[model samples]
Target: MSSETKSPTPSAGLKSNLPSTTTFITGHNAEGKAIVLDSRPATWKSFENGVMGFNQIYTNPFPPDLNGDADLHFHDDKIASGNLGLAVKNGTVCRMVDFGPGYVCMMHRTQSLDFGIVVEGKIDLVLDDGSSTHMKRGDIAVQRATMHSWRNPSTTDWARMLFVLQDARPLFVDGVRFGEDYGRGTEGLPRSGNDD
Candidate 1:
């Protein structure tokens, strides 16, 4: 495996071969019950800057040989390959996303309510109003009707986090969400074209 795939595993208060003190969450959730997810520390300090473990996966819509760092990063950030997403509701979703080491998203506006939980590392978030704030692990912030962008004021360390967002007017292909190519028009979801 490549170095990118060789990430340290936060297990039982230890990483790689280093001995440390920490807590790892291990549990599941039932449909009708309130799920209080636990994200125990991998040690006294095991922050991915912002990267959380949400069962990351990648899907290549082309030939398989396009597996490299540059390609992977593009897929991870743009195509959202490395990012793992969990559906919270029809208009809300959860994802483990990376902001960066020197991450820049050129200012943009998003009409959504974002509730972020810092899982690892740190972030210096810049809002549309030019307001900024620093966020660290275990910290949570709420962004409402805000035009904003994210930055990791660090040079050597990247930022990661668990983001829970509710789309104000999220685009949908059919009766679905994000990446409107799923279940909708031609080459879309497997719908019978019936307006229910």
Candidate 2:
């Protein structure tokens, strides 16, 4: 057959379904109303498509005096170091993360230890003792198993955070219980806005 004599039929259809992907419902609004699933919640498999999620679980029990709000968010798709799920190796683990604008996250515990570092943007860490810390870029705090909450102060900006969580333990330390109290160890330590 001549080179130009024949041609294959051209396929015509939607070539990409990425941007138009379906949203999966997983939560609700602050008013206890049905929440539209804006995006998929972060899971171990989230790293597969260069898109991870870290959002407030609106389905869980709402914190006292508060409604459903996702002040903290995390988007981590790249594996910075080690193999996938490497965190389970040491029996103790740490995770560093980056949050985009409209991002917020936690660094304290109601049931476990939480730690965080703010490399950019502003955030507020609220403690169970009615005390709170307002942190800006380059600030960090570690929670040794204390009840706490995380909030984002900016309306248009996203805060990037580096979180380090330790494996759960029966006790905060020998003879020291972190079950229902924390943040009192900061009497001598500089707090947020300390410029440290």
TM-scores for the candidates? 0.43, 0.40
lDDT of 2 by residue, 55-93 (tens): 212121112122233311211211222132312211233
Per-model RMSD to reference:
13.9, 19.8
Predicted model with the maximum lDDT = 1
Off-target runs (Cα >4 Å) in candidate 2 are 1-52, 55-90, 96-113, 172-196
Predict model 1's lDDT versus the native: 0.44
TM-score: model 1 vs. ground truth? 0.43
Each model's lDDT comes to 0.44, 0.41
- 25-125 per-residue lDDT for model 1 (tens digits): 22334454433333332222222422222322232222323323343444345333323222212234445555546665444433456687876678777
Q: Report the backbone clash tally of model 2.
A: 7
lDDT of 2 at 136: 88
Predicted model with the maximum TM-score:
1
